[model samples]
Target: MREWMFKSRQKLLTAALLLVSAAFAAAQDGAAGIEEANTKVRSYFEPGTNLMYAIGAVLGLVGAVKVFQKWNGGDSDTGKVAAAWFGSCIFLVVVATVLQSFFGV
Candidate 1:
């Protein structure tokens, strides 16, 4: 009755203490891992930034060609297509720049 209850409480307290200590140790380990992860992320960031710019440039060229074709053909949707392509290129540039700045990479 009373004895059993006391034993159970003691065991529970001991388990809680062990869990707390393990969590503390894991937190310490995670801090070092976070720094390593940040470095890896930064390494990838530069290459990715360059790749995005390249992709944007290629897209711009393709869009220009398409718009020129549409204009030559006297297509009514030429303006819309040109605007959409220009907007997409701008969006890509802005997003890449924003992400690079945000990550300090």
Candidate 2:
């Protein structure tokens, strides 16, 4: 019985170590994939990326202004609306950047 218990503990420890190592390896792989994807995306946006970024900045600025107005007590609902618009603008910017980088447009 004692031997069986020892064996069980050893198995559990080994399994735990294996799980930890696998998790670490997976995380590293994911990080590498992300880096590779970013490189690819950046390469795609070579020329038009700047323009898309500019547009995104403009939209973000407008949304920030709207949010500021709400903070100043201009309108409660307006603040929320502005925030949503800001988020949408940011999404658009990301999409544009990705497309420009990947599709070269």
Structural similarity to truth (TM-score) of each candidate: 0.80, 0.45
Model 2 TM-score, 2 decimals: 0.45
Q: Where does candidate 1 stray beyond 4 Å?
A: 1-4
Candidate 2, which ten residues in sequence have the lowest lDDT sum? 41-50
Per-model root-mean-square deviation over C-alphas? 2.0, 11.3
Predict model 1's lDDT versus the native: 0.94
Model 1 Cα shift for residue 71 (angstroms): 1.5
Over the stretch 10-98, how does candidate 2's per-residue lDDT look in tens digits? Answer: 99999999999999999999999999998886666655567777878888888888788777876759856886978888787888767
Q: List the residue pairs that clash in candidate 1.
A: none
Residues 1-105, candidate 1: write the lDDT tens digits: 999999999999999999999999999999989999989989999889888888889999999999999999999999999999998888888889999999887
**Best of the candidates, lDDT:** 1
